[model samples]
Target: MKRVMGCHLEIEVIDPTEVELQVAVSGAWDDGQVVESLRCTLDGRAVDVREVRDPAGARIHVLDAGPGRLVVDYDAEVTGRARPATGTAHERSLYLRPSRYAEADKFFGFAATEFADVVEEHGDDAAVLLPYVAAWVGSRLDYVPGASGPTDSAKDTLLAGAGVCRDYSHLTVALLRALGVPARLAAVYAPGCDPMDFHAVAEALVGDTWHVADATCLAPRSSLVRIATGRDAADTAFCDNHGGGIQLHVSQVHAIVDGPLPGDDLAELVAIT
Candidate 1:
């Protein structure tokens, strides 16, 4: 078994004149299987937190007035439960449900022809289809920062041919859905990741478990720390609050596996807020 950990934030109002603010954050993960427990602190004081589980669970939080600094701490132990693929017709049907397919109009412009060819060639196997599509996106799209957003259509990314991680994941999801695979987007903060920048990836149900694949990462065997997942990005956004001015300043992140622990470090696994 392998363990992965990280934290992410969505700062809506960064430069708020008033220190007191109400913040809503979704996608906190701390279920026994993936995460053990999650604790949140605001303005140096701990506040009551809540949890709700649905297809789209409430990893969300409503924060009351506080001080200048907001700190969050999280820990999780990932038990590597290898979701071995079950070659069954029912699994194939579940993956190919009509709801999984994206609207015909939303196909990526640059890879539309090639994506279509992939579907024509391997639509029958969900397991085979996912890796092929993920690798295709990874190799085809160049990672350019400040390129696009969650709602940016696949056509836009393909035309520009350069995008951030989210754009790449979005394009991959769009293509997977177009090919009738039930794919979703995930938000996570990787260890050594810039505090201000959250990570996004793609997930698809294969057999009885959800298999994760990130076109941006491009390694099938690498372990990923998952925060939240949904049909798309709209469902798994990080910091979401209204009526406050926000500002974000981030430094470059460095990944170190074995080093002296820093007391100020955010968290070992992904934090929802």
Candidate 2:
């Protein structure tokens, strides 16, 4: 279904010295369609915006601001479709490699033993492999909000058996990569999410397309609005500061669905631009 999704983000940087501020939280991409309805306002005033291509080819807007309030109000109309064709060879190669958060190489031994049968049955079919991994990983962990941090790795989450959405995505991505499937981290705005905030999920290369796998299951995948894609959370971070001492003030994210959302039974992996 066609939908309009967006968010209002406000961040404050409290740095007495010189610092560079860069944020990626406005671009709503889907199937190569530009965000024709995007509008951003910084610190109650309009600020110039710059675009940069992320690893997944999504346009991540960059804003430059000094020590002050950085507020962004943005909205966009995006039409999502079924997860289609695989990404370019570069996307596959990059996602297949072990990343800082998704250390797939390190989880190779564990994944091989735990999912030996699933691998044998599904082989390299990412469609089957993804759900198998998602269910297994979801069962292993207990969702605990503050149990993990940004620097936490899949190895860390696996050992702990508990983590937030990011941890779930990391472990899932790690396992998929260990099985020789290309997977990446995806940050999104979940409209029907329980806690109502930015959510993270994993996407795997299946056939010739990318598919979403949210092990947490807190939000329906069909209602997710793509924020950014990356090798890990580091690459898809909402805010990246070059040098500064900052504190986030009243950060909020929400998606106003145009109408009723599809049920989980009908939800499918959506293609994000």
Candidate 3:
């Protein structure tokens, strides 16, 4: 389905002394999906822009500024595509390894024990294992706002037994990798998400194709607008700043459907490009 979605965010920054700020907000791109009608702006200016494409496909905007209050707005039209599991071995090897937040290696023992039977039953089918890992992790954790910080890892979330969207994604991604599935974290603008903040989901490469999974199930997966994909949150953060104690004031995200809502009559797992 072709979906029209975007996000506008206004942030207030305060630096006692004068300081330069460089902001990197994820931009829409073509991977297995295509983004169109894209627009971006910084501080109501015409976007005196510089683009830096990260290794994982996040578009970074390096702004020139001596900040007081900064506003960033981004919008795009996303055309979904069918993603086949056809990546080369090198591509798959990257996500198969552990990352700072995912810590797939740390949870190897747990995953082996918990998902051992499932892996045995499904063999090499990531399609079956992806949903199983999502459902299993989702059941084990409770969603609690402000429960985890930006640096928190899957181990932390598992110990706490609760977390926000990123935490759920981290744990699920970790578990999938432990079971030999290549998975990465995806930052998105989820249209129906409650409170409407930026959201995070996992993309598991199974059966030679990449599939989207949201253990939190906060919004319909079809409504997700891909912003960035990385090994974990560290690489996909909406804002990566280089200086000062800047307070985040007025952070919000919302998306309107171009047409009537798609019926959720399909299965629980929502697979998308």
- Model 3 error, position 198 (Å): 1.0
lDDT of 2 at 89: 85
TM-score for each of the candidates: 0.65, 0.85, 0.83
Superposition error at 267 for model 1 (Å): 32
The full ranking of all candidates by lDDT, starting with the best, is 2, 3, 1
**Cα lDDT, all candidates:** 0.51, 0.74, 0.72
| Cα lDDT, model 1, residue 101 | 22
The candidate scoring highest on TM-score is: 2
Q: Write the per-residue lDDT of candidate 1 for residues 1-273, one digit (tens) a residue.
A: 345454423222344432221112223333444544444554556656554443443355445433344554444555444232222455445433322222323553433476667667766355766777877888888887777654575667777888877777777777776666666676654444433255777666665455666677632223334555655555565544445554433222222222332232111211122
> Candidate 3, residues 23-101: lDDT per residue as tens digits?
2224434464545332333455544556778655466666554456666656555565434224457759999999999
Ranking by TM-score: 2, 3, 1
Best by lDDT: 2
For model 3 the local lDDT of residue 130 reads 83
- Model 3, runs deviating above 4 Å: 15-47, 79-86, 264-270
Model 1, residue 226: what's the lDDT?
Answer: 51
lDDT of 1 at 13: 35
